[model samples]
Target: MISPTLIQAKGLRKGYGQRTVVDGLNLDIREGEVLAIIGPNGAGKSTTLDLLLGLRRPDAGTITYWTTDPSPHVGLQLQSTPFFAGFTAIENLRMFAAFYGKRLKDAQLMEHLHRCGLEEFAKTDALRLSGGQQKRLAIAMTLVHSPKLLFLDEPTAALDPRARRDIRELIRSLADKGTSIVFTSHDMEEVHKLASRLVLIRDGRIIASGSPEELLSQYGTASLEQLYIQLTDEPA
Candidate 1:
């Protein structure tokens, strides 16, 4: 069964010094759904994410969350790793949980580490881990509080094929376990593989949105890449 709407955004708008980044956008983030927001470099995808994550305030809009306070129920993983200097992997997870006002047992922390494949590196400095390991650790930190909603920005942007596949599988696992995920990605294949629904934006506005297969059939395109280009490319 489809879950209820976890987040509702209406008439979202944001601007910077006479230039608008997010222009009158609206979105619904449903429970247990994997929603992918995709667009070109300057399409304001990141800005929209920031607005929804409450990292940045929208110039005009209303975002309603299921809970009174959404922070405790939401998790976020940015593209860059934000590990504390000199902190081990497990320590960082503990720190993050503490930030959320929750103290987890050692076994619980270890379970998170094991889930992210970082148990072996529990004592290792997070910064000393490889790029992929750091990303995995970042994800583990996000899950420390066991949030109901997750926002991931380019989770697998710069990783090896194996690491990318690992992260993809992890996302699939999370969605299968009834975690609502909202993520942004430039990789069309990854978006196609993981996104239950796709929101294609241009210049801060949604040009198209629907299930990947639905969009493909609507546009009569072979793949998400072709549809993306057709809708986002500049007119000659």
Candidate 2:
């Protein structure tokens, strides 16, 4: 059976004065799937994410959500998550829970912490946690309200191999339980492991998009990295 479309964006165009970041883009985010947007530094991946999450309004386009109240159903985890330095991991979760009007019991909060593999550091100060732990805490904060749609920008960026694997597993678990995710990452391996579908953007336009196998076959490339290079590499 075909999954329902959770979000539909048509002709999404955004720019800063003369430079267009996202240009005439069209995309559909389906229910209960991981869609990864991959691109180089200035490819407007972040801008596209911001626009989709309603953080920035598109200059020209229509974004439609299937749900009547989409705002409450969405969650966002940015590249640099902001946390109170003095707050413990649990405290941070509690504070964000309050922001979402959620009142989580200590046990419930601990369950989330354990799920993120941060149970041991539940009482640790947010600033003291390792990079991986901090990222997990950020994810816990985002999932506190149990949002149906998650927007993650670089969820596994700058982490060691084990940390990246853990985060990837956590994401896969969430998807297994029916959470729809749209994320951006430069790690082609991470993208290969997590993304059910992939979209490649360059200089504000979607250059290529498809499932990993589909794209590889279409481009006749050995891997996503080679395909990406082939698609985005400038001629000498």
Total clashing pairs for each candidate: 0, 0
Candidate 1: minimum summed lDDT over ten consecutive residues — where? 227-236
- Cα lDDT, all candidates: 0.91, 0.92
Clashes of 1: 0
Error of 2 at 146 (Å): 1.5
Q: After superposition, how far is residue 116 of candidate 2 from its true place, in Å?
A: 1.3
Best by lDDT: 2
Q: What would the per-residue lDDT of candidate 1 be over residues 1-236, giving only the tens digit for each residue? A: 76798889999999999999899999999998899999999889989988988899999999988988999989899888689989999999999899999899989999998887778999999899998889888999899887899999999988789778878998899899989999999999999999999899898998899999999999999999999999988552
List candidate 1 segments past 4 Å from native.
234-236
Model 2: lDDT equals 0.92
